[model samples]
Target: MVDTNETHVIVGAGLAGAKAAETLRSEGFTGRVILLGDEREKPYERPGLSKKFLTGAEERDALRVHDPSWYTAHEVELHLGQPVTALDREAKEVRLGDGTAIRYQKLLLATGSSPRPLRVPGADLAGVHYLRRLPHAERLRAVLRNLGRENGQLLIVGAGWIGLEVAAAARGYGAEVTVVEPQPTPLYGVLGPELGGFFADLHRDRGVSFQLGASITEVVGQDGMVLAALTDTGEELPAHAMLIGIGAAPDTALAEAAGLEIAPREEGGGVAVDASLRTADPDVFAAGDLASAYHPVFGRRLRVEHWANALNGGPAAARAMLGREVVYDRLPYFFSDQYDLGMEYSGYAAPGEYAQVVIRGDAGKREFIAFWLDGENRVLAGMNVNVWDVTDPIQRLVRSRRPVDPERLADPGVPLDALPG
Candidate 1:
């Protein structure tokens, strides 16, 4: 039960929004927290969509962050399935799709993001699907079961996370998987060129055919169902089911309509927020993948779409909104387990700027620890495949940010601790 006035209205009931609500209450705000969302379901975990859950190892119940009981216990008002269609910054109120307007003292927008659409012809065909929500996974699962037919092909456009992930799942289910990517390396943008090559080798070795440098020209269908995809290279590849994972675009329509200063998407871009995650309006704050805040160590405002970032940034934004200064200066980290290889890495490795790289094991064995050092031999990133020793040393090194002897680092004989103070 909200007080009806002087409430904190939070938009987008995803991980960031939910975490903010929990933090706000935990900080003794004692104020009304109204959570508004467009999705009917609860805030769900998205990481499993490509891994354990996709392989039928985990269930949908595990995707939940906090159940209905958890919110009820917090005394926060959950306005599920209701979206704030328009924002009145001057009045501090938002107009809903139902034509209802609600005012608030503080507004936090955590409108996460959406998968970028494929602009090819016949994209609206029946067999095409995009992975973003639970309903999407449900539909894709049904499509996977369609493999009872021998000639079915799963055409995945774009080599980004979702596409490759779906490819792994589809292939595991015994479907012909073909990944159409415009870039030479699949995870090139995030993992850097050198690491991206390592990822490419992993997928290629698993029987996944990657059509690199191939842009889909059109999706051809017959009788309102997808038949095959036409590429810019004048090749028509046959397919039964298709997935569009080109990339993700921030669901910024609600924010942009709010007259907030939005930094257009580029190499590193998002809705610009100050140190406090507050927009120009001051009272209105934004977080999660929708809002891009300044990174201290990285020295750039990155619009990261990582799952951990959303979970971490949510609490940080809540503290900031509560007039508590919190800095998100952590080294960005992410992991991907495709096939038998387990990869864990972090931070941004500059283009052609690896001053020194130490490889611990043979690449042929698919077991190694690759360390990237900056100009002064300070560990910028630590990567390990089938090796766990890399994690401990890398975490300590990045936090210390001190000097390290290159000769000692290159030599695995010397304990990792023996390299630097």
Candidate 2:
């Protein structure tokens, strides 16, 4: 057990780090808690960036994960804007950017992630942007609004979650938008072709054009401002602004220098941790987007980049640090909102792991729940799109891992809770 006066240092002031600090205090640990962040702002919810926050439906202050008073009242020391520069594992101390060394009894690295940089020729142009931080979202919102006013064209370089949501938001703002994806369908890796194609249709119906199975050779620009993107197919897609939302790379430079185990990049690279969320060094822990923990539920090492994972993993890591027996076994959960569609997914399944997909309600109607099942008829994962109050039942179906009747699973008249075991 950690001594009451022992200082617990948490790196990264995102949701996971904040939640971990909250857990430590709530669990009666009277230790000194220091939360460090490189960002200027305090912990805030990021999911709103692409939807509510960017669309001007939510205020900036409301996006904060916790008010400043909470940290003060809880006696949690927050070091914002100043990033840690070095980790001296031997001395159990971290050096800040200004060369101040702070010692700690235990350390938690939650140094989230940064948006993957676009490598095209004109990617550095003034009008080209990527969404990851509040400032980026704010700038993109302003850009989209300007485009809407002038009826300018908006070009998206990815069809992933950020790309699609921004497309939806841009369309709502009256910008003529075009999304270009190398994949044949949007979200193909996650939802597979059938469902991904449904999303493509959904976007197409909303006046968003897609250049599927297309690759950009270069971003065309003039006066250091992006004007269009040249496709490998010899087509020049005109644009007033471009947003690249391919994906994010885990922020692991600190962990790497400290000699923590790192996972393979293809496997969602991050600091490697055991089932208990502890690194090779017992005094150190990792969580959030930067820690790829061994997931017992999925029976594999998985790194999840979703809000729910960070929310649940933070407390789990904190409990483990306090010498509590903890296994981060929660099924990964994530949700996305696009136009009229809102979706919640639970459980884990690689692209090709689940063979059969059973759907209830009409996909064309945009209100339905779909279940991905393994060969033995066990539900592997499930998602409810534009459906209300069914996530609990869907999650239960995935957790049970029992054979479910395909017919019943696809029948809207049959209740999910009453489905056969």
Candidate 3:
């Protein structure tokens, strides 16, 4: 039930969309809120798509963002399975796929992102998969749940976060896994060489095979089933199943159509948002993975696809959308549960910008913290993995924004506080 004056339109019903609606209600926004998603099913948690959900360790209930009854109780007019095709910025109306025009007082573009496709030939073969939505995880889960429906080995394309997580899950199911990555080390483009090598070692120790600096020439299949993936080295490996986890691109066609300005990343293709999460067009606000929001700590645009940003960035953006003054600048945080280890982060680490890197513990056996310093040489980002409880001091460093003594940073006896952010 959309009231004429009580309407707020939100596009893309993933994390950002759902969180925006919840935030609006919590803020006493008793207006009509419309939630739209291109996906056919109700909103669900996506981080588990690569791990627990992919391996059948978790059920669909655990993957949902909200229950079916939750939306109705909040009076949100959710249009699941219906994607917004266009935005008439001047008229302040959204054009749905089925020719319905919905008007709104405030428009939130949470149109998230889509899985980047594998460019090699035969990428559309029946066995090649990409993990994004629930259906994708379900299909990939079917392969791991019942090997009888499949055969041979699992060939993974790209050694990214999702790719590696999927590899770990597949190996757990007793499938022979071979990861194909064109880079010398995985995640080197973002996390840097040393950290990438560290991840490579972790995977190798877990019985996963890797083919570094190898390119896929093509994927050969018969009757929709993948048969083999031919590599540039002229070697063909038989693959019963294949998974592509290269990356994701911002779904910004609607934004661009609405004449909103988009910020460009060094790597490419994400829209720009201000410190307040508002687009150049004052009437439109954006957040989540699609918007390259500014980071005061790092002094550059930060666009993170992790759940924390998608969940928190929304309410922050909503506050601004309602003409309330609020800052969305929380230290970026995200986590991943791989094997038996819990990996977490709270800041950025520019590859060469860190004047100093503080390592609290040994990197070999886990339990370590990597802190990055700025050009003025103050703290900018903290990359902590396996630290049971050390984030409090790191958060202090981030707030104090100071540098620590070099010798103390390397010393185990000294508290991390002796060092500065």
The total number of steric clashes, by the backbone 3 Å criterion, in model 1 comes to: 0
CA shift of 104, model 1, Å: 1.4
Q: Is candidate 1 or candidate 2 better by TM-score?
A: 2
In model 1, which runs have C-alpha deviations exceeding 4 angstroms?
1-5, 148-151, 264-267, 350-357, 389-392, 399-407
lDDT of 1: 0.80
Candidate 2 clashes: the total is 0
What's model 2's overall lDDT?
0.90
Local accuracy by lDDT, each model: 0.80, 0.90, 0.81
Clashing residue pairs in candidate 1 (N, C-alpha, C atoms within 3 angstroms) = none
Q: How many clashes (backbone N, Cα, C below 3 Å) per candidate?
A: 0, 0, 9
The collision pairs in model 2 are none
TM-score of each: 0.92, 0.97, 0.94
How would you encode candidate 1's per-residue C-alpha lDDT over 1-421 as one tens digit per residue? 4455468889989888999999999987777888998989888878887777776778889888897698889888888889889999998898889999988888898988898888867899999999888778877876876752464799999887787778778877778888888887887665556767777777777778888888998999999999999988888899998999988888888878778888855434567886567888878888888887777665667677878777888888888888887787656676777767777776656546567676766667888777778888887777777877567677677667676776666566777776664
Worst 10-residue stretch by lDDT in candidate 2?
Answer: 1-10
What CA RMSD would candidate 1 show? 2.3
Scored by TM-score, the top model is 2
